[model samples]
Target: MDELFKGIADPLRREVLELLRKAPLNINQINDHFGHISRQAVSKHLQLLEDTGWIRIYQAGRERYGYLSKSAFYAFKDWVDAYLQWGAHSIDNDHGVFLDDTAYKKGMPLTQPVMLQALLSKDKTFDGVFYTAVKTTGIFCKPSCSANPRPDNVIFYDNKDDALKNGYRACKRCKP
Candidate 1:
């Protein structure tokens, strides 16, 4: 609770948290959305949020990306559910338990490239990573990218450390 208040105490930090909730972003990307703010300032704000346990940072290639903390959201959900209970609703002849398509789109696989080499390999241990340097996206992969007759897009990585270091993401079709 102390950390949550610290995170929301500053308007700038609150906004940063909101922006990252939609998608992961590096410092530059976050700064680009606002005017009259130095990147250093934004970086400081991010650090505060990270320290407060309100956000998490991950390395994607040479750049660092910011994302909302799962703990924060889960806590918020618990508070909301405790205080207010909304009635069940339905849409399109189905219950409201349906998955939210928009929220689903923000996950990693939707934007990640599909790595083919990893998909073709016979080794089950090599399935999680895929990498390619020459491709337009620089790197690509799928969780189950261990097949054969590798597609033109693939260049597999032995592990996530290598794939991420090379700037690859888990593919959308078969998310890694």
Candidate 2:
């Protein structure tokens, strides 16, 4: 877990993970996403991500492709789940502490309007940040998915499991 945290501490590494989340990319393709960073620097970050099991590298001929390893996040997810349950129970207790329930009731925060605009525009920049689930179709997709569902019928989830927990299936087209 320490290694995982160290590996993801760098903003560049996090960006790499976001890129990999969309699809596996060879080093060159990954480099294309960041013109400001050198190939060597990106390679170094990739090595760290791979060493920490956050990503997997596949070599086909001379090309090496980096793929996001979702299993690598299981430990962190478990930790977060434990705390989330604890927090929920604590919030439910009628004690001195008071909290806002509007965001929770909405399934997300007020910034959802911005997310919806990004979804409607098929913004690749927000690909890993959130997922849009269409109530009518009962399917969730990555922000960059080409399918444009009605914005009014959409709800956003921070991760695939959350969408799944809410009974939304993965989009066949985007495979969220």
Every model's TM-score:
0.45, 0.51
Query: Which residue pairs show collisions in model 2?
Result: none
Best by lDDT: 2
Computed on alpha carbons, the lDDT of every model, listed in order, comes to 0.59, 0.79
Q: Tell me the RMSD of model 1 versus the true structure.
A: 20.4
Segments of candidate 2 deviating more than 4 angstroms: 91-176
Q: Write the per-residue lDDT of candidate 2 for residues 1-176, one digit (tens) a residue.
A: 88889889999999999888888999899999989978888889999999998999999999989998888789779877665654353343333222232323334553765576567656555677789999999999998797878789899988899999999999889877
Best by TM-score: 2
Candidate 1 wrong stretches, greater than 4 Å: 85-176
Native-referenced Cα lDDT, model 2: 0.79
TM-score of decoy 1: 0.45
Q: State the lDDT of candidate 1 residue by residue for 136-170, as single tens digits.
A: 55545543332222255555455667777776654
For model 2, state the Cα shift of residue 86 in Å.
1.5
The local lDDT score (0 to 100) that residue 171 gets in candidate 2 is 87
